[model samples]
Target: MGIEGLVAKGAGTRYVGGRRDWQKIRHRHSREIIVGGVLGPITRPDAVIAGQYDAGGNLIIVGRTGTLSPSQSAQLATLLSPAQAGHSWPDEISAYPWSGRDAARPLTKVEPNVVVEVAVDTATQGRQSRHLMRYLRIRPDLTPADVDQLQL
Candidate 1:
């Protein structure tokens, strides 16, 4: 069965519910805001907000609403594929369903603790989206260089 199918079976009908609070901002890497792969003279996040999944089987990630340039849109697409690549943490933790989040409870903390690297065809100021976000669970034994070398 597909991963989604498995998650659905495990999740039943619970949703995490938290998509409307995300702070959206432009793509800010360092001090430069990139839009259409071009560096903007100023530096600032296009938008920022707190977002979470909804209660009705929909993952609603909301932030400041802004138009994404073609380049930015492309970059965003890459994130989707990675976002679906879910894994467990704690090494010994058994993969099990949770209240929400695909019915599979992520073993470690969802943010920071877990790092996902996604490939970007191009980036824009508001949101550099090319595809889907690829999920990458950090290995405690791996060095920074080891992780850096692997790009989405």
Candidate 2:
């Protein structure tokens, strides 16, 4: 079977309406993506939106990182400059599902130079993460091109 393993519960424990007595731990996935943009104010960002290049050399929107720490936000501010004219993924940003129906805040696009490793639980439409990814760390050694070489 493709299943990695299984979890077991107590023999007499019956399914209750409240929280389950047993817990199942599933494998979580992680990937490295390029920092393409950010949501919320530029100085103190809410999340680190990221992307990766496909085989065709198109920068595909992958996902955004979870809420950043004050230090992390300040550090990112130093590395990320405002995207120049004719930024890539304009349409993608406008149509991004995570923005929600009543999104008022505009996304601040950053140069896709910074690379970060993030942990994701699920993916949507095989393109982006199903939810905001957990930010692991910034990768100074890796470039955006390195994302294509990754096995994931």
Candidate 3:
């Protein structure tokens, strides 16, 4: 079967039979995204600022990941480098996930070299994801080019 998975409703919710009601639970999906920047110091980024490339080779800012553990942050730091001159993205971006975005969180630019796999909600389209992406892992085998034109 092609079913992805089921979502658990919040606490204090009674099961109701279908009776003319409309509800949508955005399912999670894994996708490859380019690391356009970070939310903290490059040496130890708190989260990844995800992005994807357009047909013209320009990077588009997608959603970001949640805070990484010390080890997870260290693991990602090893593969990241500061963005070089003429980098596609700006030095910082205020963009945040639709659900949990902090007004004080910072965005630091990085070389779009690291490719990561993340789980995002289904409400997102190519431009960006509406929810915070759950970081899966670094994809050493795939390059940013491989994520080109991918739908969010």
TM-score of each: 0.18, 0.75, 0.77
lDDT per residue (tens digit) for residues 49-93 in model 2: 778877677677777776898888888778888888777766335
Candidate 3 per-residue C-alpha lDDT over 1-152 given as tens digits, one digit per residue, 9 for 90 to 100: 33434656657676679742434566677889999999889999998888887767678888888888899899999999988888766655665345455454566888888899999876554577766899999999998878858443
Cα lDDT for residue 51, candidate 2: 85
**lDDT value, residue 115 of candidate 3:** 94
Whose TM-score is greatest here?
3
RMSD of candidate 3 to the truth, in angstroms, is 5.2
Ranking by TM-score: 3, 2, 1
Instruction: Name the TM-score of candidate 2.
Output: 0.75
Q: How far off is residue 36 in model 2, in Å?
A: 0.4
Best by lDDT: 3
Taken over the whole model, the C-alpha lDDT of each candidate is 0.24, 0.73, 0.79
Model 2: worst 10 consecutive residues (lDDT sum):
91-100
Whichever of 1 and 2 has more TM-score, that candidate is 2
Error of 2 at 117 (Å): 1.1
